[model samples]
Target: MKRRPRRSVPALLTALVLLATCVLLAVSAIQLILGERPWISYDTVAATLHDLRWTDVLPAVAGGVLALAGLVLLLAAVLPGAATVLPVDGSFHSGVARGSYRSTLQAAAAGVDGVSGARVKLRSRRLKVRVDTTRTRPDGLADAVRAAVTDRLDRIGPATRPAVAVRVRDPRRTS
Candidate 1:
């Protein structure tokens, strides 16, 4: 099942600002209709706008803040978040959580001879496995870990095969 997208911070902030403005305007209009004068005179607002120059610091600061806010919103809208579940195949008819993939890779690497433990990080384009081995020679352990991981990846048959990277570390060195 697909999860709902989380609300973006910029979008939320803009909504709040707009809501507050609407409330204030409504209150002011109500007061004006009852014959009460608005707190800030229209003349004052008109004078401020009239006096605002292109080189003024207030205008520049406001423009910069608005531009930055727009940029952040644009980025948040465009960049997709990490998927909670990955498609077993390109068709996405069946899928599994990302944690399951990591566990599968870790189990495969740990099953390799000389590997005492394994940590796996799976990204969109890369599968990084760090293996702690009992063997003194890192070379043999590294090769074995790579082959086991490669076989596991082939079995999964993801839409794109992530490049497998194996790093072997001595088990004793961590202690």
Candidate 2:
């Protein structure tokens, strides 16, 4: 089963906005019912709305902003979030956290003979490994790192195996 990241941020922001609007409307209604000064003046609002014309720039801009906001909210609500955990092959109930997965790959790459330091990035379906070595002629080091990382990935057996790309750089070279 694919695990998706939580959409709590957008959901929370939308809820807060709606709650504030509802509270403001309810307070204004209560003030009107009690014959007190409303938080928002209905007469002024009515006059402004009545005077607004379709050709006015203010109304057109406001409408456009509202439409764009609605579109963004709709897309956020409907679209699926990124995966938080990758599924394990041959296991329906188990998955690996992306952090741990990357760590494992980094360890595997770093364990190679000439690698002094290693960094791994897993994005979408790509696994990028950058290794630094003290050796000036780091010939075939990239292939070695790639082979080691690939072997570790095979042992882990993730449902969707990412393509591994390895880069070897000398520590003394700035480029």
Top of the candidates by lDDT: 2
Candidate 1, residues 1-175, lDDT tens digits: the string is 3232465676888899999988887887787788898765667889999999999999999999999988988888877777777767755477667888889989999999888889998887998999887776577778888899899888988766889898878845553
Residue 41 lDDT, candidate 1, scale 0-100: 64
Question: All models: lDDT?
Answer: 0.82, 0.90
Candidate 2 Cα errors over 4 Å, as ranges? 172-175
lDDT for 121 (candidate 2): 91
